[model samples]
Target: MRIVEGIGIAVLVLLAALAVLFLRRLVIARQGGTIELGVRLSTMVPGRGWSAGLARFAGDELRWYRIFSFWPGPRRVLTRRGLAVERRRTPDAAELLVLPPDWVIVRCINRQAPVEIAMAERALTGFLSWVEAAPPGESTPETRPYRYKTG
Candidate 1:
């Protein structure tokens, strides 16, 4: 009977410890500004019924320029002129555009610059880091593919 009581107490302690750890993880993730893609939109409202379905499909098709580390963080929307002179111009001079969450339009400023490669690599790496740092029991997508539409 004593042994049973001790075992129960031990189990309760272990459960409490686990709960603390789980809460700690959530707090850290929130503080770190880590968020999963497709989970929330920082800008445009979600469409209704059929439109929402189409929007989802559109989202699936639109190529992700980058997976930003923080949601709704500072971003730059490059213009054609800006892109053309990206390599030549100082990084500080470059204007960053903070886009609406639902904005799928990606315009390249420079036809010859390495922006696409750089952006893609950064996004991929950021996503991998997010996955690695994610806490146990927190759900994440199994895979992400680069989807883009060409005009």
Candidate 2:
């Protein structure tokens, strides 16, 4: 009887935690210019470092928060001043299975660190537009038009 009660309580706690995560995702998505994004910090293993997250444009920074995280702050912040898009590509077979059908992969450099982002076509368009519209003289020459490539 005690084991049964323990299991029931554990299930309830799990449900409650899931509800909280869902609400957090909802609140983040309600913000302006927020989009579903997948960011991978490593490039050592191709098509292996993706993590689903929400990214929002705040001022001149694009802040990323993990989808399941409880923290209210961004996990990573990429500033417009030091971010550059190196190239864009279609996700390969392995990535396509894991990512959404319409999501594209983009390689970028932020503060001298490489970051890969996977997002839908519409979100990628918005991101490029935002980067292009940066404040005068804050843009880097590296922010040139993206060269398309296959994954």
Candidate 3:
């Protein structure tokens, strides 16, 4: 019957779309500098705006792509210039449900705009190192010259 054929075609289309998404994720994960991270665009409510994504550190840009997205490009690209880390904290009860157990939250200011990133400890270390390793003349908060105490 026509109804049966329609249902069958719909199922096939759904499966094909799923396959494509899986392949895309595989390819993206295979790229170097790619790491699984959660990005919160809005910090109005803690633990409410987190979206799981793949973040790639490319040169001076951090490109983020949603894990389930079909698009081949990054959804958000954060630049290293004028980026500074404000603080780091552990997630609350609600956030733990959405984020991994070992992940930590980091607040940052990018070009004076607030951005929150959630990632595991190792990834956090790498991120901090990257931000601090900016090229000369590109200053992040942690990259400033240290002042020595002369007693």
Candidate 4:
């Protein structure tokens, strides 16, 4: 009986810790200019797939935090330079479980390496604009978000 009681207490402590971590993420995400953009780690393997997470915009970089991680730091930092969006695709039905509904997955180059990020269409436009926007004294070609043809 003592062993079982100890195990129950341990489980409750772990649950409380997890709840605290989740609440911390929510507070950080609620900060100004912080957007709840869903992201997924890209896999090059033909059979292996992706892992989803949430990203927060910090300054000029998008800091990707794993959804299940308790760590406070980002797993990956996506900067603006050398960030080329290769393509965008709508998520299929099965993917909906991993990604938000109707969100588009954007295949992009993160400093020469390929990475896939998923977010809402409007948020993607904002992301693209934020990434392409030039800094002071730097010349950048004007960019516009892509629009798909609909009938």
Candidate 5:
């Protein structure tokens, strides 16, 4: 049918455009010698699991940009305030589907909302240090690492 053919053509065109857009984002995020590491991020929703992508630590905020997204800027910016590290866990079937092998998940609360993100162990250490480091003479509850520890 003409209508079916038209629809298929439209879908193919859209996929092509999306592919180009995402590739542009990938190139842009890696510019200026920035360290863009692969990471998986997700909310605490039961059915909704992690979305694997790239993360670049830019100053006080951790910039989260999805891998397949067309947006040039980060979709989410995680700050130290209201950020709490929950626990580490091995990826389940759903997460394993997205994350890379040997990578571990670090669950945390981002701005009062529960979030889980996965990265390499070395990157995890860097993230913890980044979250714990505080500015001179301005110590807030968010800067304290011990607050995130659970019994």
Candidate 6:
């Protein structure tokens, strides 16, 4: 009986250790990344389907800090102050300026505050389309100024 009890305790300890390791990995993955201006639209709604698709696309297209969560609301607007602070902290990190395919913005605030801001899908689509359509030579005014057309 003592041998069985000892084995059970050992198994519990192993499981607990594994859980801790997994959580650590999650935190490390969430922290340490810069935010950039970029947008993405999804055909699916804002839930598991959209999240999965976004994850797959991010993995394939660019290296990003894990998407904490998305917010769905009546309007679509990225908080200037929130993003500004994040950018200031991690200048090198790419900020995902997303107008979610759905009416939502995935937001992960300090691990404890995870939310989905709502917005219009059409609005997000239009914004993303514009960004994609912009000519390579044309510069966005947000971060750069135009000099002249070289080509």
lDDT per prediction? 0.30, 0.83, 0.82, 0.69, 0.66, 0.32
Worst 10 residues of 1 by lDDT: 48-57
Estimate, for each residue in 6-85, the C-alpha lDDT of model 2 and write its tens digit.
99999999999999999988888888789989988566787777788999999899999999788988899888886777
After superposition, which runs of candidate 1 have C-alpha atoms over 4 Å from their true positions?
35-151
Deviating ranges (above 4 Å) for candidate 3? 140-151
What candidate 5 gets wrong by more than 4 Å, as runs, is: 1-19, 32-48, 137-151
lDDT of 1 by residue, 15-133 (tens): 88777655644543455433222212222432211111001112112222223222232232223221221121111111122322322322222333323212222333443343234
> What root-mean-square deviation over C-alphas does model 2 reach?
2.3
Supply candidate 4's per-residue lDDT for 85.
71
Of candidates 2 and 1, the better by lDDT: 2
Residue 147, candidate 4: Cα error in Å is 13
In terms of TM-score, which candidate is strongest?
2
Ranking by TM-score: 2, 3, 4, 5, 1, 6
lDDT agreement of model 5 with the native: 0.66
lDDT winner among the candidates? 2
- CA RMSD, predictions in order: 17.8, 2.3, 4.7, 4.0, 4.0, 15.7
Provide the TM-score for each candidate, comma-separated.
0.26, 0.89, 0.86, 0.76, 0.68, 0.23
Model 4: per-residue lDDT, tens digit, 1-151? 9999999999999999899788867866776555556655546543135565667777778887776777878787888755667678887676776677768778776554777777888788888787667476332333213332222
lDDT string, candidate 5, 110-139, tens digits:
655666677876677788777667466434
lDDT of 6: 0.32
Quote the positional error of residue 65 for candidate 4 in Å.
1.1
Q: What total of clashing residue pairs does each candidate reach?
A: 11, 0, 0, 0, 0, 20
